[model samples]
Target chain A: MFEEADPDLLPEGLSDRLPPLAAEALRVTRAMNDVLAGHGFDPVQPPMVEFERSLASRMAGTKRNRMVRFVDPASLRTLALRSDMTVQVGRIAATSLKDAARPLRLSYAGQVLFLKGNGLEPERERLQVGAEIIGNDTVAAASESVSLAIEALKAAGARDISVDFTLPDLVDTLAASSLPLPEAAVPAVRRELDAKDAGSLVAAGGEAYLPLLYATGPFATAIEKLAALDAGDAVASRIEGLKEIAAHIDGAARLTLDPTERHGFEYQSWFGFTIYASGVRGALGRGGTYRITSEGGHDEVATGFSLYPDPLIARGAGSAKIERLFLPLGHDRDAALRLRTIGWQTVAALDASDDARALGCTHVLDGKEPRAL
Target chain B: MFEEADPDLLPEGLSDRLPPLAAEALRVTRAMNDVLAGHGFDPVQPPMVEFERSLASRMAGTKRNRMVRFVDPASLRTLALRSDMTVQVGRIAATSLKDAARPLRLSYAGQVLFLKGNGLEPERERLQVGAEIIGNDTVAAASESVSLAIEALKAAGARDISVDFTLPDLVDTLAASSLPLPEAAVPAVRRELDAKDAGSLVAAGGEAYLPLLYATGPFATAIEKLAALDAGDAVASRIEGLKEIAAHIDGAARLTLDPTERHGFEYQSWFGFTIYASGVRGALGRGGTYRITSEGGHDEVATGFSLYPDPLIARGAGSAKIERLFLPLGHDRDAALRLRTIGWQTVAALDASDDARALGCTHVLDGKEPRAL
Candidate 1:
């Protein structure tokens, strides 16, 4: 009887959305998709489940354990749920649509479940809004993705969204040095470098790799610092790539080159960036380039970004302005039909009209009377 | 070593979306939201996980056990991953937004995960697009939800969409009878009733319930059949309510009434409907009215529909007509900038242009040639 009375009890780390926040997030996601679509990024959806082997590939990285896994009763194969859309795009580009095209531009919005211990404050499931650019390996491709990310943020009503650009190769070079580093020491090394701690990195390694480890800052300063590094050639090339991207973006002033911003999935290669709005502690959106080996026998380069809509809603970012139409308490069906035909989205009660007004609805009508709520 | 390689593998029943289906589904979801928003349905996103007790109380008698369950380490309280968004909406309405006004018109689009053994052939994780109309129980509210569902289907390029309408009270009357219904014999009973097997139902339930069980046809014919049922005045009043809803829909001619179409979660009450379109054998969308009782002394009545986007994409529905902008292999940064400034979404490769063309893009610019692809 207890079970019969309550069958829908949800497990931990999940939730249902209701009015105001859920509605606001939907509006933000839609507006972001619009800007992305307007910029010619086509949207796509992949099944949430895939072969566990496919999901466990190196390309998926530590994200593998976070997935919830189960055996398919019908096929008896180990099927795992997808944690991210980019890797799924990799699979689709490799197998499903492999013959049709190259350099596919795809966008997606869906929920991604991660295993506990990722350090999410609430450890909640994420409704990720993201876009992936598969099949292109050019500075322009990277730049276009960054531009679109900026535009999407702006469309979501972000006032001061700034882009922090970083080169993964810079950190990779430092990690490759002879430092006798334990596996767990890597995160510490990354943290120190991200903090621009030249002193600590030199203490851990020798003075030989100090210049490379210390080469980090806002975009302009990082570029100058990279030129002064001992591994100047590799660092110089990455800086040049960043410079090329900056030249193409109209608001280059908003670009910050933070050589120390090192936290990301290991798959990230070449140029990576994080987007932030004023007052938001974490990035509102993020993306970078990566390489994936294709079924057709070559590694394809790609870049993508996923926007966290919850934070934007927390900041009151993306609600749409609408007019309200209110029907009286007992308005007849004919009257409601007449009002709908006139393009008024009628609320069927005076109380609902008051709620609509609170949600920033500009116009209100009670039956045929156009009155301000 | 294995753990170090891939850490973020998704949990069971979740997925990543890829193009052109991902792109197509996003467009369709956006259009549906727009139609709902135009009708004053604000968007909302509930948490992906919630307390098990909260969800279970709301999901009584449904197939909700398919939801993956877990214990939150912080609280040591049982929690469940959300299988659907409706109950979460109820939670929010009851708790956080309790003071907010009534008649909350809300819409949402997100991925929902269902556990195995629910009898859905394809994977249980799905991109669910839906809206909920809360607080009001008027025929107009019901009509508006139906109209929005129809418009959303039309916008999604459904050429031959059909709505199958049913009433819960009518089905309850058949279930309440003391007929000797065997557990193994019930599916056959349902199938026959779904087929409008008046003779079979009469033989199975005997003459006492035959009149009520046999009522089925197009909307008008079913109304007459329902009138002849041997049920009492209360059941007759419920039938009258269903007829009123049937009459208010604009395209009422397209509705088919099936008293036996009782497939849904147990939360459903009053009217129910399923939408079918070409190339889709199963329901493209399903919705009905439900009454929820909250622990906080809040009782709310609501109804809405959820459209499954994966099947629509699999059936090649909701393809957007996008214009393509192609840059030559080595187009200069200035040229790319100019194209973007002029509102053309420029891609860096010729292949990307081909994908755009396949998606109904006519304008393609490759180097000096700006012509239709």
Candidate 2:
């Protein structure tokens, strides 16, 4: 029957993770989640399907579009599989834990399905592990989140992860300034700034914003450079916030400054960041400060980061091979279970003639003690 | 704003699990996975979405219908979210692990979303955890699966769990018997046998099948009762198989026999089982022996069991309450980081005037000394 109906012909962009690889993902998720828990980040689980209307409010405009929607048979409502988990966790923080405290910490890890893969990330479904801190958006909170992100990556054995900080709100300040560019030039100006192209910025009639564009490097140097620019109060406060965060970030990781980089994050109006690990392709994950408007017309500060465990699993960092002990045919069931209770992987031999050691077993027992193969 | 577009207004039947509940689910899943692993069951992760046609081949017709389907934008293929994980794992063990070894052992855990709930279990989305032994569907395999399921439930802190065994193949044997019955009598015969109504069974042209129904009880009693029946090889083989399984399953848990209990599992050709823990609502999960057809025109004996942690989590045997340590404004970041390294949940104070003790903090550091609140 499998010949005619082989389910091995999987859908494009979908996959089955077998053996050690699967074990690796689970291991990495647990390690990262443990790190978050150590920092007071609680855990949350959000269902895979939700009404499309309700799903939309959970994420920003760009991220929400990637959700795969279907009509639920029972309710006749359009349901969407979660594309992002932060939104769902935020939803919980806003309602379930709304009155618990001034600041709340929560962590989560699960799979998220997308309508399509973005860029080079080909798998449509991904393993997402994340942590979010709600109610405080100050520099101290930002530093704590970034620090924890670095520590989580370390726990997952990610090497040389670079936490690059950005000012997602920098463009708004520049666009409304004295050296105002026409509305049509905004797109080109944004492109040049993100590219860190000083020549292109000047050529696009944004010559006055060159100092800010040049302020891209290590924390202290960039802040000094940014201070020299003719910036508005919004931009200045953001810089001041960065200084406070810098004071609190005590040598846990290297921090780079990319003052004008905004991709995959349009809702963030304050500090934003992306992390890249050495020798690993693409950013591991990104997170930063954002304004979370509550149900009562009030705003709260939120910051957190999510790490994709696939890369870590691909690098083979999570789990170890299982050691096995074998029992010859008609072996004692109690003996096998007893061996298992002490954390031994016991295999009951189906045939007496079968060589247990040849079957990849470490030890064998046949009423003659567990002897090494 | 949340008032205008609160994501917390989730779609019907979809909900968020916060704090201790989420941690509990994770804990239970890990404990169960550990038990399976100790028994030589390897872990596998099947993606959340798959091709509908391939998915259909993974489950029985009754379950396949409950799978939620949607169209993929890129591949233009009709994709379905996994309503069941057994099929995906089966697909892997048949194809990917096809040549690895005989009698392969694999385990998995993940979330499943259905088009609609089955029976009294109304939650459209459910968490599934299971371990499967492929290539050896012998009585030993069945015994191991049942024993492992009981061990897993205990590892998850389930109380007084009971495993109920059934002969799903008995009905087909009875239907193909020598006696001829009216079409309308078929339902009545099945009902009588399922209810153990020996009198009704005689009236419905099923008098010859009464012994199998009357044999439902504990293992030794059931086999003794079955021995008194005038049976063909087909009916006699089932009783013989049960006896072998009973001999192998010792000191695991209580086991009961139900010869005519058929629901949600029509694909199984032989032994089928469901597990329930006392003081817990609903069956934790079910599994049994089935013919897993290989790619090369051969059927391998397969046996496995799945356990849902939700019921155990509902019983509240997961993670302990999270403890908190508050650091006053401008406290040392290194001190906070060091404290967290030792399993302390460190939360930095956001406001100077805020009462750290009243904020659910068990300890605080305010320059004077580190003191318990």
Candidate 3:
């Protein structure tokens, strides 16, 4: 049994949204879905709680241990609140959507909980809006997902947005190289190489790996540099795919390639990218591909991104255009009914004049005197 | 530490929606917001987790013991995932939105978690879409919220819908009457009345309470009967308010009044209502008025409702229409890009003819033929 507290103290890290701001956030999330749906992405809402073993067992490394877990009294089974939507999406795609068509494009918007320290310093419940494309393994499908993400972000009012592209193959190439590097020396190699540390790269993987690490830069230049390197077949194949993606995007110059940049769950495969805006310190959204092995011997490729909307709003993105109309006090109920019937957004107030300004009314009607239309 | 699995098992209850259905749910939830927003309701989104203390303490009866509780790692405090949106809305109204203008009308669509048993027996996680109005306590505001809910449901494509209204004061009226009843006997009395068990009502509350209990019928007729009931001041005031609401709705023929309809959290005051549709035994949505008394002597009133959209969708209420365009193998990439730029939802396929029908595509363009558009 737990001791109850006095009512004054609210649970920490949770706060309520008031009228205008709350209204705006909801509007933005809806608009995001509208854009996504228009592009053929469908919505899927999963249950918030799931079997703890199913969620945490497969998750690699330290992240899984942070999930909030409890026992369901009725089932007497351990259940965990969903820590992320992608994993849930993966589960659904593998199970319920098994016999469905390949290249399934699903989108979702919901609140996902994570144990503190996964991302944000003081973990807060985040309102995440995201989309996932499963079973599509082609470069064209991947590029389209990226394009749609940019368009959706723009539709959600994100301005000056840019996408930073990173290839997982670049990291894989470095790891697979015949460098007699000790395990402890890997982090330093990754960091220094990411920072373009030539000396550190020479010290770790030797002068042979320098050109490949140094080739990382803006998309086009990096592609050309990687082509020029004496890289093996795997590295060369990755470069070709990256070039194809760069060629397909309308403004390929805006895309940056960072060979050493690695972010995302360890499960990510090829073609990872992040969306960045001015005020947002972290990526506004992030995603990559992961392979799911089905019941039989089939493997499905899935990729998607989730947007952290609170920071976007805090950065002055996604403010709703509120159109308010005020009806005068003592207005005829029948007339108000008529207005409602015609689909007008209205507020009927006793003190119409005061309420109009407070509600930010764009249009106000006088009840005292009926005017001609 | 946790045992590792093969990652084949999908977390229970969570789902991934395929095209058309996922698209349709998005459309329904969006349409709901459109209708609510048109009725002067602003949208709001609250955190998915709250302090277990804030949520449980305010819940007056059995509900306090049923919330899903877990320790939040960030705050190192016990937190409960929100079992319902109403309590979070109340906390916001009492604190954050306290200074906002009176009669704060807000709307929301999100996932809410309930402990295994409270009401929804087998299913615990639910997608709740609802609206809340805080501050001013008026029959008109309550009626507006109820009407908006009905309109929203209808817009979500619910063909058969019914709204059931009940007065909370009637329970107080029966309790205060000299109808000899023990504390535990009250729920049974209320249940019998709700089920219209006239014999049970008479046996429990006696002949004096029969008039009020049996006064359940069509909204208008029930209101008329309540007006004539020889009840105390509390019951009479509540009855008068119901009459006023019935008069305003005009289409009182569609409304049903069950004086014994006892549903809602303990904090609800005044009128309570639930929306029901075909194929769903439980109410598709439920909400009512709530008055909060804080430790600092602050008092606030809020009324709202939440819709369980998953069940509504399960009953085949809201689904989306989807059209897919498939581009054939060896198709001109430039042409596909042009089509996509012009707003066509296109998926480029290698060997398109083989997968076109399986992709649920209505139209397919062969890359070999330039004449085919």
Candidate 4:
């Protein structure tokens, strides 16, 4: 398919991150991970490849299509590189930490390779940084995760992130409720809600769901708009849980509410959030509560978030600004050590004929002192 | 294939590096890359997957077998996950940086997945950290790269590393020399040399190659022993070049010489060195002078090194020691901020019923005072 491309070129949707940029990505990842750790989230690294059973269960329908799979030469079993980290974290919580205490806090940051890219990020491979707190169903757990996500993003230098909170299982809840969406009409109505097409959703779900259409805006306005509608008891309880989570968040980031928002999020369940950096077009990160099923098929509650910091890194945060100091041939090694200790990066001249500047040095050692050239 | 193992279990050769270990690996990678960058090695992160042509050439024989490969869905061409960074660096040196001025210094660190682990490192995936100096073949360039490698290892907390120098292509060099190694006996003699078997090499290649057997142990004894041998001009010139590179290195790491040693390294053209940390069983790293071939087949001289810092990181570097501080529900946010600014990792209590210490905090804040609980 890439007939015109050089064989050495990267596979489509993949990229090669170089200096300054590579360094930037690392910096952002560390900053966010450190913030998670500060909040009692311990880091866990999963393998790049895992058996399809461990990685594909919760995300079976959607994730399986994007994973790069192959037969393991040693084991001869089907193996796939993870397209996402959430389900893997779930698997980890279920298996490795199976016997651990309640509310297990785990954090991770690594590269994930997708066979195909999604609409938001067209790159097949991306660096994903995330934190998950498992086995807690309380609104407090959801609130803490949300606040920490904002703090982590802020630590990564993302300013003015607007968090749009929504019910992840709203589509399922509506389908089960008395909304009378003949199984065939549900997909169309869900698509309209995902598109935020007000008129179209009303035409599909009818007049009773009009409040869902008006439920887009600030949390204060959206909650009252939703309160005005007669959503069944089952849906009402979910909305109350959303309210509790919202009330507990202390406005660490810009907070908004979109009750009927349901697209792009594959695993979120109870209270999901989509975060957008001020000027960036797509969501910077996503997180929510979801049911974690154990290897024994017993399910429990969990909440967490995953962030793709490329957009934050794109704005040029945390790049190295230090220029190197060159030690010309025959320069004192002791002097170079002293210069390096005092914050100058030392690049030694390899040959007597080499010019320091030509060798990419910004400063050169003259006698015992460094002089800017 | 994994019929008896749990579904969540990793393949036999893979592993999950949790918390402290994962953090340690990242720290060691950053430390080594920083040292490389200090020496004018601009960082270049190649894609995790590349066309087999870019990664397998030059390393055409040995590396191809170990690479985990598949047909790319996008390109419809065979693609392989990189098993080694050395050849990919060579490709970068050839294409993207073709016009990069003489002595191009580049550095990189990333995860490489292998189809099967080498005998030494049984894990299928490893973090490979390295730096390459392309374009100059002078002894001074080799010296600089060696010195920088030791300095980087030191930064990563590895102690007492010894560098054993050997000519990578010495067997072939001797095979082509006036010393008649019977074409049939060459492979047998080479195997003996690899095993450090002096008696076997003396039997096959004859008594003339006795010094090759004697050229073992510390650099002082081995170099003098080899110099005393009746070696022809070609071998003598190569030894002299080794001596020149030696003169430039000031013994930052223990130096030894093994003129006949040739095994894991298949890419080195001249002046190859293997690194060993005291008490570490396997080679910590390997690097040497090599010739680069562009896509058009134009050749250029280059030298560099690749380090497997996982051994160094195994010794507890960069694991966080600071315990988190717990801010109980209703605790003052300003007080928590003050504590955080003073090196405390503050984890806020999510609910009134939460026990701070149970949530993994060492100290809990009460009335603006943090108390050990």
Candidate 5:
């Protein structure tokens, strides 16, 4: 009977970050944010909830169904807990920071809530740390984003990093001109490409898109294969842009090409890349070129990346243990402050019977210095 | 036509933190969390949402109405966004960290969402930074909490800090013996005391509780007035506990006594405190002794404080300006990294037309050295 009434039960797909894991999460987030700041990305914080229309309209492909929603008591408008913070940064660029500068660099780190878990990933809440370069989607902006992403992941203690590039609008780019197809067949062709099913691509009237499937793995070879395909000049500039970005981050991180990989690149445009590390379970993060559509229907180009560092943190990356000093009852307070100033964690005794080792302290305060227990 | 579909509008009581203000919020949160960690408080992160029953039933006085709730599709159970993180800490102490040392110290910093804003405050979402001293609620525990809270607030750039102390169960302690009342009249007495209406307090059959109304002033004077009240020896030990806690933080902050003050001290017991700082619009934080009721119906004492530092962040405290160096096209990348290593924020130009001053850079990179703009 009491089991059913347990007050400690957390909801499914959620759990508390206890001890070292919690510290690791904070450290990894700070490290990544610091990397962004070092590159002149000023940090910005967007509230966790916003009007559903506001959240969905700032960026195309931001699905309203993914966000948890409720009616706002004040406005009677539907409010949504943010499923992605990228749109929020876009909103800020279009409104509050609209006049700040061109090619604005802003960073944000926050918890985003989703209405449901996707596929095998049962995490409804995740910590997203990212940087956005607004007002420009040039080849230079794309290159900067790719380089900064690789650097940020390395700063967070991720090892053997790899980046897999994609062109989110590749199908649209091809279908518009060189590889003409009926507008109705576009979605099916994109789906078949994502499924990597060549037979299904033909069934979807995308027989000419088969060459795109084999253009995967090693960036250098894959780019050559994609360039050799007879899609005319429709994707010529895009292929050259991808080559430039790959050259920029060549020595820093392992690079690959999959022009049709569209798993999490819902709002990405011409360029996109997914990051991975040797020991991590899934893709560490993704970034690419995109556009922020303003309230007046004007679209401003931009490039950025958002990193879901939970997997990296869960692997115990970047958490450093500190020395702790136990202060007995009646210990000198000034002496304890001195120790703390030099980086010692101090826990004072509440009473005479309190034990030092039991409180997780490795040393006892001996006058002003910490003496090993 | 665009006005109806504007996506830039945030819900009432919600706003974005842009530019310097956003950076300041991060700095303030880090300073307070650092103070917590220096005192040996291990960091923990509880998810933003939990089961409605789990959250509402963790600690006494946690109202379910304050939480924003919705159905969890996976569990088919009601899920509520956390309105307070203190009860979540209590649940962790009783469950996940049950076998840890006595007097466990845990710190947490996160965003909490409420269903509605309180009168005058008008903030439905807030950042709460706090530390808990679980497994103990002794006078020493209360003293540590008071001292830590003041220190944390000061570290976050608060000045002229003041703490108002109260006994949340004062009426219960009095009505049980000295000023006995019908069980039904107890809540009315509490309401009248909170309102500070002397006439209504008497009308509520709390005539003998009138002395507590006079016990509201500076700590030294008001504590004495409370001591002079002709109650049985019921409040004698509690008054002593308050005195000891005051003495511990005597020189650190201004102290006051209001034994019947019970506005937001819903779950507090023998001791409670509300912290205020000079220039801040309202209370910075509150803490006191409380008991955590486990699923087994066992009560374990705890003392803690949660600081809402948004007011201080809004005041632009703790944000430091850094000189940004703009790297023109074809500038040295290694030199820029070296400049960043020595604390210069570097923003590289995306193209030749990008202006340094427009991007908020105080200096531009001239070879390896920064030339003031």
Candidate 6:
């Protein structure tokens, strides 16, 4: 007889969220979603799978290879599991919501999958909670996006929140006028600047772009230094836009500036930002102004942020133990129901010899009232 | 120029849930999940994808072919998107919570995907919300599963809910003793009985099981008719169990009994039920006493129900328009914050020309209070 392999083994990069951890994750998701909704962001839910081209074409820099793809049995066409829902929201805005009012505020929270994990991050699946302000990407919209992202993180119990601003299109803004670079050398310059290596920055024929490396850190002084740079008209307006956005969310969170940071802001246009909090490892979420491709392939400006709050959830998971009331056999059902309505978690006994503490109950229902055991 | 295919074209059976409909789905899910939690069922979240062998081997009758499968690039192993979450819950109970406590109550709500649509229904992805009572499948456990499922549906705003009970293993129990059949002839007998064709049942060597076909309808009469059948000890015990379960939820929901209905009760053992509501097109949910396969391949008795409330959600979708408050440019930010805290969905204007009614606002924030449009 052949021995069967272990049935409890989970796939690599995937695991079960058990007990209080699962409860905490739900709470965090609800908190973030509630914050989004309170600000009039209507919720939207897109199917987990879609045509590979649909997802890839909605936004620039959405890598098709990163999404888990398979041939759909119904369509006989390849379908990709969504690696990012921002693109799907863009699709919704451009199609189903094309006739809706301008600056359509749509929010979503769901599991997103990737074919491969990011470097040093073993997790391939994450909870992406986000809100998109479609049809506008003004400085006011940028300000609202940054402030809302901070508020959402605070609601989910993150403290000492920080917003690091970035200019996804800073190179384009500069190369067009102020700091000219050969057309072919643009990618190399962006790559070197993202790496923050001055030597590589000069080697890429971007010696003039070296000033951007210094024009970063603590938003107050950084923005002023960036403003002092003679980058002509386009760069000047963007600098002022960043200043206005920074002033709007100044006291809400610690502010920083990295005008040319482009790690996760692949499709963002003029402005981008990454959020962080003390005690939470890495970035809590990222947001910025960007564009959505319409059905006619025309670009519509939008601003939004997507928050991957797994770290926040993990940090808070299993820390809070719920007060459970054990209801003995023959206890009043109506009484138990009433208690449940009042927020008491009642675990009813099935038979005799059932122990309350063993079942993790903090209280036992004695007659009508819960008596701590 | 090469004309591109529509970027908004989603894969067949997949869709983007827009605005109010998406909000309704979230509300329905939360309402049901809250009911489960109030009943002391600790929430658990399992990943959308798992190893094919892990998912398939955890429970009997979970079809591997029905799940959407893809090769995991990291492990070079086949990974399957879950078609049913019950098996995943069973695996969690048998492993992670294996030593915590007996009679563990767990609840979950998430998306489940299928490779193929069911019969005439074109949906391949559905929101599956459910709760499981692990380590016990007693009459009381079965009773709780039935009543809790009803309560959840009611909480989600379903009206005139009904529960149709079935015994998944009815034929096997009877074929062993009271109405004996050749071991090889059992499948045909069960199939014929399920089809409700008396002539075919007799031709299929299930003539002795003829009365079982008539033993279905309203729980009161059907159960009495079933009880009158002389099927001896095993059948007698099951009949008593059914009676006890019915008595527990007597007035809560309209009850019916179909002792051999096996459509959606594939892995259920002694008892199974399908729940429905008036105005909803099909069954809202189903549950039963069943067995989960332990890592050592030993069967552990468990009872649970999974509610696919898509039809219910669709019926309620777009029926509720939220009351939104619009704040004009330069409106008091603190006043708007206070209003939002009290559940007013406030959408702030980006410019002076922004119209309140055009943005779906039912009222405009005049000073501190909302003035109806």
Highest TM-score scorer: 6
Task: Count clashing residue pairs in model 4.
Answer: 0
> Which CAPRI tier for candidate 5?
medium
- Count clashing residue pairs in model 3: 1
Residues B1-373 of candidate 1: C-alpha lDDT, one tens digit per residue: 4433433333344444555556666666776776776667777776556666776676464444677566566446666656777777766666666666666777776667666634454466776778887775555566667767877777666767778777754544554543435555555666666666678866655445455455666777876787777466656766776676666665632878776567673566777788887777788878888876775467888878788767766555434454567655556656656666666665555342435554445565655545666
Candidate 3 TM-score on chain B: 0.83
Q: Which ten residues in a row have the lowest lDDT in candidate 1 chain A?
A: A2-11
Off by over 4 Å in 6: A1-3, B1-3
Q: What's the residue-level lDDT of A87 in candidate 3? A: 68
Model 2 lDDT tens row, B133-201: 887777777877887888888999887777777888676665766344566777888888777778888
- Model 6 chain B poorest 10 in a row by lDDT: B1-10
Clashing pairs in 5: none
The CAPRI quality class of candidate 2 comes to medium
lDDT of 4 by residue, A129-180 (tens): 9988888756778887888888888988888878898886776777778566
Poorly placed runs, candidate 5 (over 4 Å) = A1-4, A182-185, A199-207, A317-319, B1-3, B178-185, B199-207, B230-232, B317-319
Please report, in order, the local distance difference test score of every candidate based on alpha carbons.
0.65, 0.77, 0.67, 0.77, 0.88, 0.88
* Candidate 6 residue-wise lDDT, B1-373, digit = tens: 2125565777767777777778889899889989998888999999989988777876677888888899888877889999888889998887778776878899999999988787777888999999999889999899999999999998788999999999899899999988899999999998988889999999999888888888899999999889888899989999999999999996999999999899988888999999999987878889999888775655688999999988877778888778999998879888999998998999989877777888899999899889999
Candidate 3 vs 4: which has more lDDT = 4
At residue B158, candidate 3 shows an lDDT of 71
Which has the greatest DockQ?
6
What fraction of the correct interface contacts does each predicted structure contain? 0.46, 0.75, 0.58, 0.59, 0.78, 0.81
DockQ for every prediction shown: 0.36, 0.60, 0.49, 0.57, 0.71, 0.72
Ranking by DockQ: 6, 5, 2, 4, 3, 1
Q: What is the lDDT of candidate 2?
A: 0.77
| lDDT (tens digit, per residue) of candidate 5 on A167-195 | 99989989998999899999999999999
Model 4: residues >4 Å from true position, as ranges? A1-5, A60-62, A118-120, A174-189, A195-205, A230-252, A317-320, B1-5, B60-62, B174-189, B197-203, B230-251, B317-320, B352-355
Per-residue lDDT of B321-349 in model 3, one digit per residue for the tens? 44556777656767765655566566556
